[model samples]
Target chain A: MGRQVPIVDYLVLDDGPPHLVAGRCRGCGALYFDRRNGCARCFGTDFERVPLATEGTVRSFTIVHRAAPGVPVPYASAIVGLDGGGLVKANVVHTPADPEHVGLGMRVRLTTFPAGHDREGTEAVAFGFEPA
Target chain B: MDATGTVAPSDATAGDEVWVLGAAMTRFGRYPDQDLIDLGAAAANAALADGGVSMADIDVLGAGNLYEAGSGVGQRLQKQIGQTGIPVYNVANACATGATAIRCVYMAIKAGEADMGLAVGFEKMGKMGLLGAKPPSGEAEAFEPSGRYGSVMSVEGRLGTTLMPGVFAQAGMEYAYENGGVGFEQFAKVAEKNHRNSTLNPLAQYRKEFSLDEIMGAPMMAYPNTVLMCCPTGDGGAAVVLVSGERLRSLSDEQQARAVRIGASVMTSDPWTEGDQVQPDVNTLTRQAASRAYEISGVDPSDLDLVELHDCFATAELIHYDNLGLCAPGEAGKFIEEGGPERDGPTPVNVSGGLISKGHPLGATGVANVYEVTTHLRGEAGDRQIPGARVGLTHVIGLGSACCVHVLEKANA
Candidate 1:
């Protein structure tokens, strides 16, 4: 691989251990993964970049068997409520995609994997949550 | 605005109201041979003939479509039928395209811009597989942060897939986790009921009935929603003719007798909510529209003789029971268990088999739901007819988030 890059701008791969960066609304403290013009709840324009907690619990999940072309199926996709204060949508990795394997309220932690490589051989890393 | 948070006033004056002079839908099924115009004209002509009027009498036309929305579908349809040189409104609001089209006509009449209007929705979709979010064009060229996040393909499979089944499955699972009693069986029963109901609708894409065993045994599309529970993509069209109250009085006695009064029409988008940031809250906007429709119509949820709700998935149907106020919040499980939505039950729902079995042709679905309700309100729905149906409600929700709800009442009821 030529160079490793985080799939999203919010994912900080250079700083020691990989972690997600989010914009915390200064007004109501609402956390978001990407840049925002204004807070949806409070309409706050100012925000601070903050690193999210590495651990969270699954709020909800689904075993997606059907998907668009080129995407793998039977993966456990979840809505994870991060510790401290935040919610995210991501895939639950290192486990089977089933109710018995991935369940609601299950504890998980942030993890990264290679998404794909571009023409220049730069590896794109994507983030997901594995059972903690 | 008065007390009670906001004022609820009828869209029309006390004496002047909008009425559905005629409502018609071509049987929802696959039609690889016919095009959009052919299907649309057939439905439009049927509605005009049913209303005992010609296209010359229509002052406005609203066309609801999605695939070819930018091409002025309304104008193209006018060319097929008589070109009355009427103002045409072309609208595309995701799955609610058809209902939005009808609303355009309804508002035109209610605003006194036209005394008579026509709204038609048609689709020529053949067979599209699972509805999923596709990567944005030009974003996949290089790995870069384009807008909200990374390149669409770069983030693919990282954040849960936004495929329709997965989105709704997660939504349903979230509800079941928060509110106890909803399970695999509860969801399967919904598909079973709709499939059974489809047997009575001759126009439904699938008329065969599937048992609970069959539904549960079907291939899984998502966690709780099986392939059987999902709506099939197909081609069809539906149309409705609307007239002002004054114009209704001028029609023949038989025509006036068949007219279904438009009690209330309301459309709402998603309100600011915290959960919506993480997942689509399909309940809130639907509840808002349903509440507003009830307030404006002065009809309680209990007063509804029948309902035609958007059941794009079996899971969607369960939560909408609560969203539509058919049952108390968190009581949707009990509502399904007790057969509350059965055709012969107190609150009959999806008697037309819904999008589940009746088939969903995107543009056609929204107006088709209205057509189902209007048919029952006119006492024209045979076989599957709810005895002496008087008041009925039709609801449609399109996820980029728009919802439309209309309450129909038998004239003079």
Candidate 2:
């Protein structure tokens, strides 16, 4: 998990890091990490540069037994509360451990994993959370 | 607000006394390892024990679970607690599964269907996944890109992040910017507060307390919404015991004192035609339910002492504060900042740490709320109890953006 990438922040993504994007609000001076074409605060359309936090709190979490097309199967996911008031819903990295350990208020950090190879021979990446 | 113009036949203090002769619950939170039927059985036992009733005393069992498929839930629960030949049913109303279960019980006893009845709800939400929605009841299902649906829609209803944390992040950022740009620190405060309250709850899904630094440092799923703002799925169960007036006579002082009356129960679905909030008509359900309850119980919100609202998301909880008439309209951000529903406030919402702090188990959440109210009413709620709580109410709405409200009055009152 250690190849240097051209991310905005060494620990964070620049814009769309496969599973991440930046959202900016025009009506309000609020900037978001997830891509929001319309500003949630004031419904503004303009946006600027932003990167996501690498770490956050586990507001809530769960494991998925069923897998859909895009997400990994038999994996864990959490609703992470970032350090900057931003909330992101992503899968947890570790799997099949005690569900009790992944609970509300638990610390988690964001990292990327291979989403699998796309049909076009391109490597796909997605975000997930790990025990911090 | 259009009043139903409906008046009750009986005035307050003129109706027959209704008491909770039985109450029980399985511990709240994730329990993927245990069979749901086992959990339901445990709760049923606790409730029957609380009511001091024999298996023969349980004439009817009203059951609910959000997720449809569970291994041996129906049989396992009945096998552990009740004898064969008891009605073990499943009720699903998205999030209001528990409320509907209790309401059904109230109706059974009031109709003289049974001297004593049990309403039990349990959920293994993680087993069902999030778009665990649109009950595969074989109805025509439409997949829209936007997540907001259900309830009353207004022509002017603007769509927020329908994916949840997305909509709420917009709200949180708006609130922060509205207040001169507060940052993640403010959001952390919320997570910190709710987690602290949860620590005191013995049955809470999470018992650990988090610090501001820890909350702020969490992952960011949505802008302005960090890991701290979301309530992921969990597994849990909740149960309640109901009895006619005749059964309360022989209950121990502990059970007798906890005999709270179910003054009112109401429910309504979402009106998606209008362009108001996610469901502009959604609040109508709560209001209607509360109105009917107040009429039946003779206690208005003003006379009520505590409450538990569905706080699926932090912003949702904030919006509900104003929507429920706990405060003026569109003033929820101010309400939270001012300590309106804080532990020491006039009315404390989510005293059981709410879905935000306790982890939402969907099907069981409705029943879970009632259990907390009952505990607080009985003065048995250890660290999270409201001091001398006499009157309490609970509200829950589901995927249809339906609203279900229940009002309870203390035995002495």
Candidate 3:
């Protein structure tokens, strides 16, 4: 296989299904997908590495017809409440980007795809949600 | 430290009072040729003229700008308006930039730090969109990993490639799905209302009104938000002159008669939360700020004669109706249906067309809100004046997120 890399450092790529790495606060159990110096909830600096659930439910979504440059338009962006008590914002993919196709409280699963390719032909992978 | 291990009390809130002696703003619209310095100077000069004061009389200067201007920008602005070697402080709090500047001057005069102060806010957003991208910097890069910065990169990397319109549209959709049935029509009604209200405002960016059908038919920027429902980016500036009661006594009777008392000014930031609720996430900050302002001013929301809220988007105004205590939770649609917030209604809102129609020049918006409220309080808002307006409130929210609420009362009321 050719070289591949994750767009954000929080996403782990392996032979198996993609996993989201997060920092779990030891005191308050608050999870952060990105590395955090401290926990805002409990003001605790101690944290443990944890992997988030790959399944989630869409709490809210919108079909954005316009976005910043280089971001493809007409994508369904959603706030997905994960199964184990965390929230993630990701694009709902593999379905039409419309209110009829994607909706609130819809079941979705984490999936990975190639967002872009480097000049060296290396694929940069990104994560999204698909209908579960 | 005291012997009892308690610090001595600071007389920050002594018996001194602050009043807005003058308020002025440049018409909010596109001004590609004008720079930030020029806009800021125009507003400052106009406010001084309106107050019948000279630049040499301004003791301190507080300037607010979001993205365009930075370090030493305040000094540059003051120099343009004939600086007098007074201190100039620059403040930036996203959309609340202008209001924060006003708050700084208000507190300074109340604390007897200065006899008179000027609060000016200006923006020259040439092509920057509503949610513009900040230039790369070390601070921005450092905050990127924490996901605390509300940038396009952070939002897109975490969520999808969606802008602000999408974020707010999701909230509107979620609110509609969860609460008492609200439809796209209700959102369009807010746009229609604000656009219609703008016709009476000479300084508004969009003076044309559109029918509900036309608004609904406009190209959708997001699912629920059409182009007309969103406030367009523009260039403008606004300024306010604040004076202490001691200084007001020294001023001429004409200037004192035009003054408006600063009843209260409260600023609040976002509370730390584990996750975001689609409806009441950032809005909770607004509620906290507004509650404190009402308490400090001893003015109930129902008793207020008018309101100038941060209506950056149509849904935001709808949500603010409940957040600002203008109506009960989930009754925003009902409130609009009853014409409670119209110009001649029980409580006039955004009589100056709000951000949607008045144009959002970011840093200028909060100060512009103050200018509008002050105009009505002084009985000078011709054609769009609220009849016998006594008390008015202004609220602005900045996104990483800070909220500032200011309550104004007629000097003699």
Candidate 4:
């Protein structure tokens, strides 16, 4: 257990720090994460490597109840519009328990958690939201 | 030809009618405790009551359910509620399920297939987890490219809530840069406005009050859409009762006055031969539907004092504010900056807080629009009522593929 690194995470670590990832369209200026069948903005098929935005504002949010097994209960999630002009919904963290204070349009940004720490320590890392 | 010129089906040679004698809805939310069968029967019973007729009078039963388990819900409702030998027909069309059911019953009556018909939309939203919100991949099991992913949320559905918030963030940022100084706070003002109006509506899922700063500080779902911009999922059902022309007018003035006339109702499925730009198709549908309703009812868009549009997203509502011709196209965003449509604007849309505030129960949402429109026309939308609302319209676009627009008037004839 002396600083063991998963093969996938170790491989990606050489590429960049902060380890954020997104897909940028080649044909159009559209941006997406995960793989896209086609570009939603300009219907462009080509995409390039692009860094994910670090900051944004909260658009909407909700608190989840009855969590799945191995996950924390009463998790906070939100829609964050990034500084680069796009939106992403993720779990909210380092914020108040009540959603009233989370508020819409307030400045927010991206956050990441320890890989494999979530649920039985899988190699997958996750993102959370914080006050910008 | 453009979308507005399309002709309406000529079912009436004048004096023919499809009268809404009854309507009902299941309480909207997660039905962890309720069964679909019970909910459907209850809604059908409520509709029968609203129509002043018993289930015995129903000649046809049309059930609209979005979940796979509810495929045969209409027959179950007919069996439980004991309809009068009515042939039960199940209708499915994604978010437009209810509208399809209503249209089917109306067309069946117009064609003389049934004397009276029942249209019901029931949803057990939390039962199978989420009924929709699936991937856009063609290979996925639930992928029905022809299906609707709700009217507004279709674009950002599978992408999770992030990209949606991002677009809103861009719009909000641009709005601030364009205007002197306004940002999320401005969006918060609109949320505050709707939440304030929602307190008076008992049917609303979220009746709690929220302040400007409070909503402004809420967690963002996508950057511009805080939790307030989005609608909650609720378990609810709505039913409509329709009958032929003669049986409707025989009632007293008080009874006759409650009749919500269906002037011209048209459902259009867009041809996918073109690209995915839905703005033109929607605009075309609205114009043509409005035109036909105007011709049939002899009233135009300028004459309507109220409207209950499909405001699934703030962006959709903002875009539609112009597309619906409430004002010029590009100026739809100005209404938020200004005090327009504040439940007292020149022609208020969604005075009942719409899907955003009132809640969207998927299968029941289309019928819910009808309920709000009918209430406004009947002068019964208590705190959010549009005073002197005589003629109105309820237009709901399902996913991007189809749009169902109905032109309504107060009187049957």
Ranking by DockQ: 1, 3, 4, 2
Select the stronger candidate by lDDT from 2 and 3.
3
Question: In order, what is each prediction's RMSD in angstroms?
Answer: 3.7, 12.9, 6.4, 9.2
Best by TM-score: 1
CA error at residue B68 for candidate 2, angstroms: 3.4
Tens digits of per-residue lDDT, candidate 3, A1-132, equal 777777676677873689777788999898876557788778999998888889989877878876655556688988888888777778999999988999888999999887655555666677899999
**Over all chains combined, what TM-score does candidate 4 have?**
0.65
Model 3 TM-score relative to the real fold: 0.90
Q: What is the lDDT of residue B203 in candidate 3?
A: 97
Worst 10 residues of 3 chain B by lDDT: B136-145
Using lDDT as the measure, name the better of candidate 1 and candidate 3. 1
Candidate with better lDDT, 1 vs 2 = 1
> Candidate 1 DockQ score?
0.60
Off by over 4 Å in 4: A1-132, B1-14, B127-190, B271-297
Q: Over the stretch B354-390, how does candidate 2's per-residue lDDT look in tens digits? A: 7878877777888888888887877888888899787
TM-score of each: 0.94, 0.65, 0.90, 0.65
The per-model DockQ list reads 0.60, 0.03, 0.42, 0.06
- Please compute the TM-score of chain B alone for each predicted structure, in the order given: 0.94, 0.80, 0.89, 0.80
Report, for every candidate in turn, its global Cα lDDT versus the true structure: 0.86, 0.62, 0.81, 0.61
Could you arrange the candidates by TM-score from highest to lowest?
1, 3, 4, 2
Winner on TM-score between 2 and 3 is 3
| Per-structure clash totals for the candidates | 0, 47, 1, 41
Q: Which candidate order results from sorting by lDDT in descending order?
A: 1, 3, 2, 4
